[model samples]
Target: MKKSTLALAVALGAIAQHAGAAGFIEDSKASVSSRTLYFNNDQRDALSANQRSARGVDQRETATGLKFNYQSGFTQGVVGFGIDAQALVGFHLDGGRGHHPNSNSFVPSDTDGSAVSSWSSASANVKARFSKTEAHLGGALAPNLPILIASDGRLLPQTFEGGTITSKEIDNVTFNAGQLEHATGRASSNSTGLAVNGGSKESNQFRFGGADWKVTKDLTLQYYYANLEDYYKQHFLGLVHVYPISEGQSFKTDLRYFDSSSDGKNGQAGYGFNNNGGYAKNANEVDNKTWSAMFTYALGGSAFMVGHQRVNDDGGFVWMNQGSVVNGNGGSEGAGGSSFYLFTDSMINSFVRAGENTTFGQYSYDFAALGVPGLKTSIAYLHGDNIKASNGSGDQSEWERDMRIDYTVQQGVLKGFGTTLRHGAYRGSGTGIHDQDQTRLIFNYTYSFL
Candidate 1:
């Protein structure tokens, strides 16, 4: 075993030896979960003569993921201390050299361009708590905030190495702050520094602060500021409100806005900042504004939603990227990809190009209302236009349709077993976008121990 791994084991053993102490074993919890996923993607309509000559993507693969977690209660003291340990393993069940592509969306590929057999990783966090505030220091964190969200679209979820503090000492308000140093991609075990999309230079510092306030029983407001040193700085404002119409019926509204600009080296030459594949009025400087609004109505077991989003003409929506990082001990395949907080973030594409306007809608139903429990389905569609092309072409447009169905066993030995089916189709005209079809089938289950 590696020296690092051995040392980690020794530390964990020491903790286990003290499990009998107060608050150590009495409040401990452990759980294991597994997921099996089948992914397929078919790209249609070649963009050029070379693309026509080359093989279009028509690949399918299957993989399995296992996750184990252990959480220990805080020690007995005015300032309590605890630890959390998590481990992940992924196994590639199918996909050979011919089926594997450079995309590396599902499984990491070997040097010969074949899917890897297996990969695994482990992480731990040391935590402390006082009053209603808590601090954590560790790697393998999955943050779900508007400014930064970890991607979990693949076999494993993306993780970040960082320190974060969250406090709720005040009523109706919550505060959060964090400093992230590195990120591990969903398909690889190695971690790398951060950068914006299409940027090659890695920035090790990403600082953020945010707050969520509940102004009323039915309304909430949020504001956040984030900076990726030498990349970009961003600020976000959000609002959410709900109005009850009747029993089992309500209306909801959500509004979001973002303002961003270049930080340091982004505006300098020799630095990797080009507005991430979009038209930036100020050359490589990050200059963009984006806003979106969504409304939903619910009656009984049915819900309907519609939303619109606008991306400014200066540049495409910007966010962190790790795709260009140099792979260390982990495989190079599937090293970087990301998720943005947008309604247009769909299965096949994110309609975030420069000068884009997107309209989206969705409808969903719960089968429980129809006498069937643990079953639900939804369908959504999005259309985007006025995309600015870098080649001086006219505006481009694209559309996508997605459908999903999920079912879970509610009782018996397989009570926690769950399955989901998702499909999406996309078509575009005038620019880099392509026509594609994608599908995913997922099976999941979990067991808990105390």
Candidate 2:
């Protein structure tokens, strides 16, 4: 059994011995959710011999996942305490040896390059609440912040192992601080230390602190600082504002900026940090600046959004990645790849090359406006240019177009069932990656039992 599960078992035993905690038993909640996913990726461009041998030009996979969650209310006391537990199991539906490339995108591969039949994992956390502040410690954390985001793009969601404290004592202001030691990828059950993309060295310490201030009813400000020890340090600043144009219509503005620099041992020869696959002005040094702004206009069930982003000429935007490490541990098989808090982080690509400038726009509509409730569709396009190359020439560009539709049953036996379809096409010139097309189909449902 995993350490987290064992710890939770002991805590539950202790709670059961003292069965008089009214809140713990009276206000508990439990739920189970299931997701079925179909994924396909088609490589349109030709690849070199080595690339062709390493991965399939066209790949497809299908899988199903079940997730169970339980949340116990805090015990009635001056300082309330509680526990949360989650279990996830995945089963392979289709995807034979030909489809399983050992890429760890949707499922873990065996030694013979075939997808595993099934996998399961469990996690738990203990939490304490005092006034308006709460502290949590455990291995099942999905943090959504400007610097880090847990990916749910695949069959399962990524999770982190760590401790975090959130305080909302001040009116209209919230404070957050956390220390993360390891992460469990969406496809694997084991956990590993943190590292930047392309870096092999893992750092056990990831420290972060942040604050959000609601200056007014329509405006908010955010600032955060994060560091992956021996990898990189980052600072983030964000602003969001919503302006009311009239009834049922509004204009929203979101602006974000990030500044990153090299930490210890990044520029050294054997420490394995080399700007995470982009050209850096200083050899192996982590130096980057990224900024983006998005504006949206909403009226009833229709919304339109446009945004632009710029990556400084020094290096590509850097974030935690654990894909390249192979430590002989179970985590090495399916633990890698992460998501960043950016609109351009799409299904198959991220428009974050060094010296790149990107423009993007999207249009979405809810069918409820037309009397078709629980239906929605959206389309988006992004174009990027001025990517820096390794040979001192900074000429590269890429573009992607994406479309999605989703529907949820509003009534009857399958009232909570949901279906989603997504497709994307990407093309690039002078970029290191290839042009490709990707599609995903998903069905999901949830049941609650208390």
Candidate 3:
């Protein structure tokens, strides 16, 4: 057994004795969340015979997901213990052969290149608390940090197998640390080692640490560091501030920066980086610096946001991506989807090519101000240019536009029911990327039981 699995077993055995303790039973909480999603992607660009054979024309599918969660509070003692468990199941509602891609970015695919009927997974985390710090060890970790963002764009959310510690011992400050060994993809039931896009070999170790400091009520600073053994190392710094202009108006500024470099074995045969199909000063090596700044102004129910991001000329930005990681069966492990923390991580494409400069803006409105309690809408656009290509190819440019609408029931039995509709269109020139339009419709509801 893995060390983490063994540790979890021992911890669970120790905590079993106190499962019925006062605080444990009294503070327990349970909930079930349901999500149904309809996804459609239309490729608009023309393709050659080889391209048509390898890449499908488009993708359209629908799936329903149910997640059940149970969180038990810490037992009463100097050192308290608890457990968080979750079960997830996904069912394919619709999608035929020609409309569904064999790649499992959205839905699990069978051997015959068809969607699976259903899939399920379950996990539990053993936790302990001391002072103001808490630690968890399990296979169901979903981390939202500067170095990693658990992906949830599809029917189910990606999960990790690892241990994490969080502490708030210092006032106005938070600390986080973790080590992940494996990950379960959003559409996969099995867990696999970590790797970036184009990397076939997997790395078993991914360590990260970070701190967030609230300097003031409206000001915050963050720093984080991460390392994927034999892959890459990265550091991130961020700052956020909000300035109040009036009773119902404020201005917010957010800044982010990242520095990444190759680690042990990086650029090796199976550990090479593709640079997202962009230029790299040193072929197959990780070397990049990126920075972005965003400003937002809010007045009443209206808000506007704008941002600019730049990627250094050395290489394209990099993040954890298992898109090309092959499984034991010599097939994709259904782990192609991933998420990164960047304004350029749009619905269809991420504009992080080397030497790229991107400008983005968004406008949003809430209908509550107009007496519609649970309605909201937003639209955004992003344009990127001066993207350097490999082999001394000419630079490229791209643009994307996205729109979203969300509504929720505010009363009666469906008070928490939510509906979200989103659409995005992307066009690129000289980038070798296909132009596409995408749409997603989602319904969500959650029920709580204490």
- Per-candidate TM equals 0.92, 0.94, 0.96
Query: Which regions of candidate 1 fall more than 4 Å away from where they truly are?
Result: 1-19, 47-56, 274-276, 326-332, 392-394
Model 3: residues with Cα > 4 Å off, grouped in runs:
46-56, 326-331
Per-residue lDDT for 446 in model 2?
91
lDDT of each: 0.82, 0.84, 0.89
Q: Kindly give the stretch of ten consecutive residues in candidate 1 with the minimal lDDT sum.
A: 47-56
For candidate 2, write residues 1-450 as lDDT tens digits.
756557656766766654468887788999999999998877768565446435644668899999898998888778878888889889989868655666655887765667789888888788878999998888778888888888888888888888899999999999999988888878886778888876777888889999999999999999999998888899999999999999989999999999999999887765555554567888777889999999999999999999999999998888886635443333246787689987899877898878989999999999999999999999999999888876546788899999999999999999989999999999988786878888999999999999
* Best-to-worst lDDT order: 3, 2, 1
Global Cα RMSD, each model:
3.4, 2.7, 2.0
Model 1 earns a TM-score of 0.92
Identify the candidate with maximal lDDT.
Answer: 3
Clashing pairs in 1: none
**lDDT (tens digit, per residue) of candidate 1 on 1-450:** 644345445655655655566996788899998999998876766445345324324667899999898888977667777778888889999866445555564677666556779987788876778989988777667788889889988788888877889999999999999998788788876777888876878888899999999999999999999999998999999999999999999999999999998898886754556654667787777889999999999998999999999999988888886746433334356767778888788888888878989999999999998888999999999998888877534378889999999999999999989999999999988756568888999999989998
Q: What are the clashing pairs of model 2?
A: none
> Residue 11's C-alpha lDDT in candidate 2?
66
- The superposed Cα distance between candidate 3 and the true structure at residue 437, in angstroms, equals 0.7
Residue-level error in angstroms, candidate 3, position 80: 0.6
